[model samples]
Target: MKRIPYMLLLASLLLNIYSAAVWGFACYAHSGVAERSTYYRQFTAGSDPRTFSVGAFTVTLLSLIVFIAAVRKLRGWYIAVAIVQALFALLYVWQLS
Candidate 1:
């Protein structure tokens, strides 16, 4: 029960990393338009990059909220997590642009 928030944070981190990898591959690979499109669709499970970014943002936000609401102590740790999540969200936005 107490571990759920932490688990959510971990999940969000992994999600962002995976999305970054997918986006990077889609951008850097020297492939045909059709091939890139197909790879993007397959990597993102049929959803586009924008949609995936939004979902990742939502999960990061949810994890922060859950951590704040569930944990009574660890203020410093929470702040660190919040900072990392914020940076990730910013990176996602940058990638989309």
Candidate 2:
């Protein structure tokens, strides 16, 4: 079993989980901050499908890449890049929330 692919998958899973958790928390917290009149606030209240689709597509793509990389026995560095990308993406999700 190649280690890189598993590492990438693990990292991406962490990202997916983090994004879900942050969004969940944000939605919960918004009930208290309902009076804010920001455009972002409006977007959330409207429950934009585009936002969810984009997030799902991106995470799925990352998962596919990781799957391919693992089965193809790609180089360690490539898998490491995926892990790095996933971690940063998770951080970005938190920032957005």
Candidate 2 residue lDDT tens string, 66-90: 6775575656875675565656565
lDDT of 1 by residue, 1-97 (tens): 8898889888887887787787679778846766666677888889876677777877877877787788887677678887888788888677567
Error of 1 at 65 (Å): 1.9
Scored against the true structure, residue 47 in model 2 reaches a CA lDDT of 44
Clash statistics: count for each candidate: 0, 0
Best by TM-score: 1
Q: Which RMSD does model 1 reach against the true structure? A: 2.8
